[model samples]
Target: MSSNKVYVVGVGMTKFEKPGARDWDYPDMAREAGTKALEDAGLDYREIQQAYVGYVYGESTAGQRAVYELGMTGLPVVNVNNNCSTGSTALYLATQAIRGGLAECTLALGFEKMQPGSLGSTYDDREQPMMKHLLALAELQEFAMPPAPYMFGAAGKEHQERYGTTNEQFAKVGVKNHRHSVNNPYAQFQDVYTLEEVLASRQVYGPLTKLQCSPTSDGSGAVILASEAFVDQHGLGDQAVEIVGQSMVTDMQSTFDDKSAQSLVGKEMTRKAARDVYEQAGIGPDDIDVIELHDCFSANELLTYEALGLCGEGEAGKLIDNDDTTYGGRWVVNPSGGLISKGHPLGATGLAQCSELTWQLRGTADARQVESAAGSNGVALQHNIGLGGAVVVTAYKKP
Candidate 1:
């Protein structure tokens, strides 16, 4: 099928809150976000030809129920679940529809109403989806902690043993993201902390403090995608953010073959996905001015620097030391605070990243905006990953 240009004409998100902190349910979250997005684009619900809704914890037909709150027009509502990458998976599908000439306008919406505390297996009667990853990790290291932190922390420890990455370096990520969250009104935790404060926060695993981990959140985010023709017809040219490139990759043979902790948690998958997106966009990492990467854990952020080609392997620590990833640096990353501080409502995470990047490119991110976001050569990059595992990398720029 021939491809057509796709643009994000509008984006919106609920202020991420702790699970059970808000009285509203998933449908309400979807409505607020979806309505804002439609309004932002000056489009009516009837204009949307298709919709995709993503959530990890939900009943069957939940997508239909959620979209019904927006409009009962019976448009196709595809439910998506790809672990934490669910949101971007939905966005990826919507992009395909427009690119393939199936739909001119589509909505990608995601939300999660999570249970408080560390994530765990939901069904003991059935085999866990992460069994393969868990088994692979067991071969490389002992499992003494919860699965999530232990896996990522083991990767951090590996980076240390191989490259002398210190706990201080990993802690710096927590500092940078939390500090960035202060300027974002939508972040769940806005209070900043010193390096010592972050390090001293209760340790969940080796070099990982509670501060570095993404909290289970309850929120929703929505984005409206349109074909280039639709954008022109709707007079959305000024606000449209073009999706120059996007790629989603799952686990590879190296994930199990390399027996490396980072590889186990999707290092190579991210690398290949980022490579594909750069090739598709016809731009490299150097052209990016802002980023909204998945920082489910601070360690993953450091490892992703190498995976996304932002830095060489084992040199992520030096990147942090040079302050190259924050304001007044080489790139302003996680300007919306990322999952670390903004909260990780699994399904909502990727759409939140999309929303943040869209706002950045439009020069409307206000206090959380990057100074170089409007640079002629600048583009925004987004990375979202899940441990089962899947990763989506996307590049965006103002039209």
Candidate 2:
């Protein structure tokens, strides 16, 4: 397909809050984020020709209702849901509109108002979306924990048993992300914890502590996508960050065929998507200066290091021990605190990642900024995934 240059001209998000802690609904969340994004771009709601809104636990026309909070422009509003990757999926579609010349300007917005406690299916009348994956887990290990923690924790256990990865390595992810959140005003948890505290916290399953898992969150995020012509026409060149490459991959047969816990949680899908993004961007992992990867659980973060080609297979433990993924390391990852510390509102998570990377590439991220991304040649990568399953890998660069 033919494509045109697409750029993120503006981005905004609300401080992620524990669900029910905020007395807002999805529409309220949408208005704050959408207004900030429009103001950031120096544009009006009418200027957006289309919108894509993402959420997982809402009724029909929720997208339309949310968009109406911004304006009743009658633009086509597409509702999207792909489990945890919903936000970036909306982003992928909006970028496609600009890239395909279908729209000069578009809005990708995501918000979620979730119930507290561990995630469970809304409907038990039908088979769960992750039933197949659950069956695979049952065939391999005892299925005694909640679905989300069990699958992810089982993957971490497999990594430990197979690759000699230690529980401490996974716990470090929690420690680093929590520490990084101290500098981010939007993170849900800002207090730092020691490795002992993280490991000593309530154990969910395997090596995963309660501190390592993302909490149910209520928040919203929005990004404005513009074509090159639109950007230049509006004199918005200075703030535009280019979306150089992107790819989305779903589960493959190997996901179930491999009979491995890691594969069951989207390890292979992430690897394929990351490779495609690198090829499209004409750069390798070595070129990336910063990252905002999905760390729904600390275990997934470690698994993603190898999946994103940041290190060799079974070498994630070594990389963690060598201090290669934090500030002053080879690459600064999850500088926005990641989902573990930042809070995961499903639909809002990916847009939050995009906002952070855009700030990093623009050298506007304050205390959490990575020095490498503040340079003229800075490049950033984003990885967001959902099991049962899909993954979106994106590459961004300062324009």
Candidate 3:
């Protein structure tokens, strides 16, 4: 199908914080991020012909309520919830609108005001969305901890047992990300930690330490997308970051049948999404100068390396051992400090990833700037996963 190209002309996000750190609601976070996005794009809210607002814990029509805080122009406001990937799902919808010529401009926004402590089910009356994953985990490991840490920590243990990935390697991710966060003003945990410190930090489950898991966060993120014509009309050439390739995938049979931590945690979905994105963009993993991906747990980040073709199976340990996934390495992964340090606010996570990548491509990442992205290749990649499960992988490049 013929399609108009979609480009991200502006992006904004609230500085992620721990739950109850701020008394503000999701709408308040949404307004701050949305207003900043408009100002970044030099466009008013009225110029946004449509919008997709994403959140996981909120009332019905929360999308409408959040965007209404921006200004009600009667624009279509779609509520989106794909667990943690809600932000990217909303982004994907907005991209479709512009690419399909349905709208010249669109807004993709996400926010969450989460309760403190570990996440819990909001609906006890209905079947859990993650029942399949949970059932598989029950067979593989006992649930002695919160669902997230239990699954992820078990996944880390499985990785170590299978691939000889040591706990030190897992702790290394938290150390690197936290060190990276020292330069990021928006990160919730900015203090740096040593490898020893990370490993010694309170163990949440199995090999997963407190420093390796993403904290419950309250935040919002928004990005403005425009068609080529809109970019030209608005003279947003310098700021625009083209959506070179994007793909979203859901769980398949492997997620249930494999029984391995990798498969149990939507590893196949990440692989499928990344493979398709690479094929569509006509670029391999080596072409990517920077990346912003979901690192809800250090284990997930390690698994993602293999899924995204950064390394071969069982080779992620070596990748981490050599420090190949950080600055001055083959690829700069999670230069925003990642979810481990930057904080993950459910729906806001994906859009926050998008916002960070846009800043990297635009060479405005401040101290976290990826020098390579400002060079000739100028490319960025984003990956977000929701364990129900869905995964979105998007490739971006300077226009």
Model 1 CA deviation exceeding 4 Å by range? none
Order of the predicted models by TM-score, top scorer first: 2, 1, 3
Rank ordering of all candidates by lDDT, starting from the highest? 2, 1, 3
lDDT of 3 at 373: 93
C-alpha RMSD values across all candidates = 0.9, 0.8, 1.0
lDDT (0 to 1) per candidate? 0.93, 0.94, 0.91
Candidate 2, residue 71: the lDDT equals 92
User: Which digits, one per residue and each the tens of the lDDT, describe model 2 over residues 1-399?
Assistant: 246999999999999999999789999999999998999899999999999999999998899999899899889999999999999999999999998999999999999999999888999899889998999998988997589999999999999999999989999999999999999999999989999999999999998999899999999999999999999999999999999999999999999999999999999999999989998989999999999999999999999999999999899988778889998899998999999999999999999999999999989999998988989999999999998899999999987
Q: Point out the higher-scoring one by lDDT: 1 or 3.
A: 1
Model 3 lDDT tens row, 1-399 = 235889999899999999998889888999999999999999989899999999999999999999998898999999999998999999999998998889999999999999999999998999988887888898888877589888888888888889899999999999989989989888898998889999999999978999999999999999999999999999999899999899999999988878787788888899999999998888999899998888999999999999999999989989988989998899989999999999999989999999999888888888999999987579899999998889999999887
Please tell me which model should have the higher lDDT, number 1 or number 2.
Answer: 2
TM-score of each: 0.99, 0.99, 0.98
How many residue pairs clash in each candidate at the backbone level? 0, 0, 0
